[model samples]
Target chain A: MTAPALKLKSTALNSIHRKLGGRMVEFGGWDMPVQYPAGTVEEHVRTRTHAGLFDVSHMGEIDVRGLDAVAFVNGLVSNDASKLVDGQAQYSALTTPEGTVIDDLLVYRFAEDHLLLVVNAGTTDKDWDWISSHRENEDIELRNVSADYCQIAFQGPDALGILQKLTRLPLSEIKYYHFREGEVDGVPAIVSRTGYTGEDGFEVYASPDKAERLWNKSLDAGNFGADDGVLACGLAARNTLRLEAGMCLYGHEIDETTTLLEANLGWITKLNKGYFIGRDRLLKQKEEGIGRKLLGFEVTDRGIARDGQDVLIDGQRVGQVTSGSPAPFLKKNIGMAYVPVEFANEGRAIEIDVRGRRVGAQIVPLPFYKRPKQ
Target chain B: MANVPENLHYSKDHEWVRVEGDTAVIGITDHAQDQLGDVVYVELPRAGDEFVANESFGSVESVKAVSEIFTPVSGKVAEANDSLTDEPEKVNKDPYGDGWMIKIKMSSSGEVDSLLTAAEYEDFTKAENE
Candidate 1:
């Protein structure tokens, strides 16, 4: 069949990916690699065991500037932005007026007067419009900077030590979820100590013009003298790693119809921070306790229970699985879904409909496989 | 892709069948494994299960997606690869040899000729790419 006529949005590293023999797939309108020839399992294991490089430039980046940027951004997000010090980052959420989530994002405080918002790719346009339209202060400037920048993530236990070897920036000085602008290999970059994989990693942002070169540099360093140096990961490994880390996927766990509290991301919400979008509804939900809570599960049978599969208890559908797969590291099928708060505890028995058969499953604590401390 | 031996017959759905006596050893082609990402699980039919030609017998789960395994010819499943439960990645490593999914007692040996040759399979995949 002829390739679809739909134009795929290419990132700065598209040509580089093609050069690397990446199997390309269209994801959320962007032509991104789903895996390299070494494949998704190898990439997933590499990220956990050593280091893996990923081109996440398709994710939307926004810049909030001007005098009241902090206050303006804080008022629009669910997290306590006032607590984010300069050069630090915080996971936060943008909510609808009804307390449903607009998107989960990471807010990096560049300075007291400037902030950077990294949002999910599929929800970037909506997030940008929501934040810009709700800006009460005219001093704040919200610009969609996604096109102007590229994000390359090097995630694994050795990520920091490897990065420190190339940068003058003090690696230990930067705490988790923090950003520091510095020169690595004499190249300008913004190094953030954060990652989706359950390992210590850094996300570096650089100019699109220099992104390809920098990506090559990182990949070269990652694979230095090894049989398979830095492995290029695709969306498949990325999803598994993030899900293993117990992080929520935007449209799956949290979306336009689910509040942060119900999504079990209330830890990021600051109830006492006064007003923010959906604050009233979130506060009410908190007081009443979430009706249905997102819980993690592992299949005890052979079948993999995928998204939209019914989660049953005693032959009745009690909840529905949101996301699931066979975890490469754990060698077991695991997933997350919304279940009644009473049945959300670890070790609770649940049945997943695998085709026409109800397979045995157990509610388990997330991070099915955590990286061993180095 | 790895070599496609001339003795093997291929199906358009990317499965390869090798006839040894009255039984045929069935496995996916190297090109199929290349496209499926990494094999994590292989769900094979029981030994006694019977399937019609072109019908799905089981599924192969990769890290990326789960694809059904189509029978190239109607037959009774003589044996399934139970070892795949713990080592599905073997299919990704050497799909033609140790990665074989099942052994079937062929209902009719004549059905084997209808399948594609190695050259035909290569051309088929190339045309698919086009």
Candidate 2:
């Protein structure tokens, strides 16, 4: 492939990746691993059944501190920020005045007056500039801590067990969508109960200096198991796992042109709360149902449906797929698409046009596969 | 690493065509599985299916990308690998051994000679590396 227009940035583990025979691809301006020597399927299966390690250092981290941090952040995003307790995290969308999504991010209340926002890698610069330009007072200090931090994800049933071995902090105490700052391997780290995969996993945020050490330590513990406890996964398996977990990617599932209601993220919108940038538009959407909505589908036929493939209902095109792949956990082709509201219901039968032929599909509730209970 | 037997004729697309009497047993090469990642689903061509040279005969789905498995030579498919229905990952685990896709009756044996030699395929990939 020709060199990308933008420089493909690498994580701390880039050298480690090259040594492991990873097929690197340019993804969102990041020169990330697409697959390893074991291949995408095995890495995916390992993540679902055992544990998989991922270097998410490319994602951006922003810290907001000051007495007015809560109020300052509350006016900026769609979610109710005041309701988040210390150590709690919530998914929120930053939007334009017209209610178009700027980016979807995770907001963690680290202290009574401080918050940490994790933004997407590709849009980090934009998000940072947007937030910076809008800051009017010293009451809120916005710091782009992206460069200083590196993240390692241990996802699957055995993730917690492996993580507990390294941290003196009680791993079980951290609830889902929450995080706690503690020391691991003598390095200050933030352990979060958040994972894209729908499994009991933890995302560890440590300094770049300590990233490789933490990763090797996690691998050395022999967590995934007869061969190795953990396999280093790539962006390929990460995308599949998140899609299987019914998580929405920022660009594909929701963008500046789409609203939360249309993106099926209405649960994060609160009308009774203090005002935010897109509150009025979201309230309007609540009063009137969205015109088109995102829905999940399972391909019953042979072909694997892909992004931009047309979704047909009764021989007429109804929508288009945003993200589609062969679901490893389900062992079938599954994806998410944006369709007319009338056809967005779960269990509705539909057809997807693969190449030229129509393939039988069913509009299933998202997260086509959930990890079997531990 | 997967097994790549020396006796089989291989194509650059990572397919091995093992000549057996009047039929040729075709399967993906070990390199193909290494490239494909995890094998979640496979779309096999039906028996008696006619394939044109270099045209897609089937498709294999991994966690990330879907790749079309192309025919190395023009021929009629006699039978598909029945074992793939339940053990699709066999391609990844042992491409040359049990992951064979079909048995094809060759339309032209001349086409087989044009396919890549094992050494040539390896060199082709090595040259393509970043």
Candidate 3:
């Protein structure tokens, strides 16, 4: 007989999500909402024009402390963490010795010996194990703080205004990629000026007990009473927003088999930072030249190209689509795929096997959409 | 609760048919559209294409997924809803009327009688959802 399936874990906001009429789905071992009653399109558009609140508590957080914390973290990631000052965050990736990405994460420097690493939900256990094993007699201490905190992202053009209504701190003073410790709705929290939607937004981290109160206060401050007010968004809207921004999803764009260089993330891989995991392999790959490169494309034909669909050049299969969808805001079908370096140029014509039909497409620049400058 | 017209017929796959003499208008049920979230694209069969009963005639693409649309009876496509090519969201706005997907010249009007009635289809979907 087959073993029974394990129950999916729920975040602190799970009950609130259900109360708000969110449709629950299993995502990366977590029972998360894919969309609320307003649906994905409304939530996505509202996030672009107004604001959207996201419960990102499923994402993992790790605390690193000790005299050698900075050095230890720098030795594991691809980006230069040494450049970050107190209260600043840097986007980086954990790579295996073979130069392939283990996971992309955010590193926050709270002080000289204290740092916080925010990682993807699915890779939390693996990331913890990997980072713990690499300590190897170092005096650093690593603690998985995922369950201790809940993360909420308030994103979009109007995010700052909505967030400022609840806190006394001058939110405008918090520069992009910087964070501050403040009380939100009478609860101590970490307010970071960062988001994945390529919009002006802020991510708030608070203790689990205080998370529900913060969520409720933020929603009330947003005041969804007006049609243009803040909307409660879900994972579906999050996926589309990040895709339009040309941000990479862990499983879709980067994985253990995909290297940083091939994924067009070479700028973050600092070879001269003096020896890190995957440094030698990445150096060799850089010298030898990358075989394939990730390219973004817009569907010129009728149908939408989905993930795992075949990409063809003159009817000959060359590559496969990693992620694709109808960009609700742009009013076009867009997707990303890995193709040979020769075919990575923009404006190049190609065909995607959308189902059985060969649909026409054109190579386009990364970031299918960008927000207008304020 | 989804709208289910008492006079029309429905399929287990969520399609509904309004029979008018020998020609039948087909569209997805209201529950189908709601489940699909936002309809982005609808791939319809060309006029004059033939399909047997229960055959997949086209697909409807939504923001989160793609759902195959099947025919309830053997028929030839008389007309495809051209407006959906540019305005697929009409399915969500008016699934029973303006959102009709195709007009099929039925091989036999009697075939629809064998499909689910409004009451039966409602019961079917109720069980499916549960």
Candidate 4:
């Protein structure tokens, strides 16, 4: 069930979505579209093959400005923020002192004194409170600027070409996980070459009031109405794409109790940097092996395993499904689950309790789908 | 707008029933299939299995969710659409024609009268959508 529409918040493109026949639903207490008339599977496929535009303004953004911006952020997050130069972004998680995920966020370093944090919508308030409460002996100024910007995710293989028409900032110059500030369709925006989908794309961050114009311009430039054109996607399509990409979502793959090592995010956890939040526990866990590890699997039986279902081995519960869905591009029933470290191999046999039946499945590699390397 | 067949009866839960003699063929309504988007799987009850009125006998899975398909009038399952195991998309392509789910030997033929006709079902779905 969802919250009533009256209590939910909407982004700047709400009216446009209604006109486009989007199926509106409540997500993170925001009245957002879950899918459009193109449907979830088709939208997912379109994003993989062509292009898909998404209204990601619901993702929270926070600005941290001060001489100690990078140091302050590094002390709280799991990544080594000091390594970032201008226009670089990294995926990091805010962890408790004991090494638990408060939320997973993207850290963008505009300069040594300026940074922007893009957090999940549902945990925005809580994350704000956590960051604000931790301010001590730091000269950083934190501002919650989520409502000031409309973040548009233009993802797919063809997205770069479509967005390049709007600006002359040498879109090809921006490397992956990097961004450049410029005008898009004559509107000032941050054109970031980053995305959640397994395809190369750009995410434009512009003023909230300018959302409609930019959205329309991108569609017009891409000739959205034609077959094999750009699609206006919603949250459902975004979720499916991220799942197939082997990306983790907050509250599903990592929660307050799930550790970074257990979630297989060792690449982002900079232990050699210095003492930070959750470092000691991470050190301890490193010395003593983790009990469970996150792994990927595909349902061999004719069924789909949803989140919160039990994963079994020999009809005994050993783990739980975290995120499960149809990998539209891959044409398989895939999901992520937390299983015992002993059974986390790539070819381990597992069963998922799909409702009342134990559906056959086997542990596989991390990404069920990956874009071809250029 | 959904296509409501005049020769069939529909339950409030959106299952269509086509009664012929003591056996009734069942499938989901077009409205249900449209709301569900692209169907990926359909789990039906095995033959000889029994059910009562309003009992959930099977489920239909879309790309994102799985919805229970309840039976309006219940009886022993006489036949099931086993072909759906390999080709579930047929439920979306031909919901009423080739995608019929199951056939049950009705225990009480009077239950057929309780379902709404095509006209009544159309009105009911219109109200529900609004």
Note the B-chain TM-score for every model.
Answer: 0.97, 0.91, 0.97, 0.98
TM-score of 2: 0.90
Query: Relative to the true structure, how large is the alpha-carbon lDDT of every model?
Result: 0.87, 0.84, 0.93, 0.92
What DockQ, between 0 and 1, does each candidate earn?
0.63, 0.45, 0.47, 0.51
Q: What is the TM-score of chain A in candidate 3?
A: 0.98
Residues A31-128, model 1: lDDT tens digits: 99988877777888878877888999999999999999888988889999999899899999988888888988999998889999999888888888
| Runs with alpha carbons beyond 4 Å of true place in candidate 1 | A227-229, A371-374, B108-110
DockQ of 4: 0.51
True contacts kept of 2: 0.59
What are the clashing pairs of model 1? A223-A229, A223-A230
Model 3 agreement with the true structure over A150-228: per-residue lDDT tens digits: 9999999889998998888789999999999998877888999999887899999999888788889889989857688
Off by over 4 Å in 3: A1-4, B108-110
Model 3: pairs clashing at backbone N, Cα or C within 3 Å: none
For candidate 3, the per-residue lDDT at A96 reads 98
Candidate 2 all-Cα RMSD: 2.8
lDDT of 3 by residue, B8-76 (tens): 899989999999889999999999998888899999999999999899999998888899999998889
**DockQ rank order:** 1, 4, 3, 2
TM-score of chain B taken alone, candidate 1: 0.97
Model 1 docking grade: medium
What are the runs in model 2 whose C-alpha is more than 4 Å off? A1-6, A38-42, A45-50, A222-224, A369-374, B1-10, B18-25
Best of the candidates, DockQ: 1
Q: Which ten residues in a row have the lowest lDDT in candidate 3 chain A?
A: A1-10
Superposed by TM-score, candidate 4 places the C-alpha of residue A361 at a distance from the truth, in angstroms, of 0.8
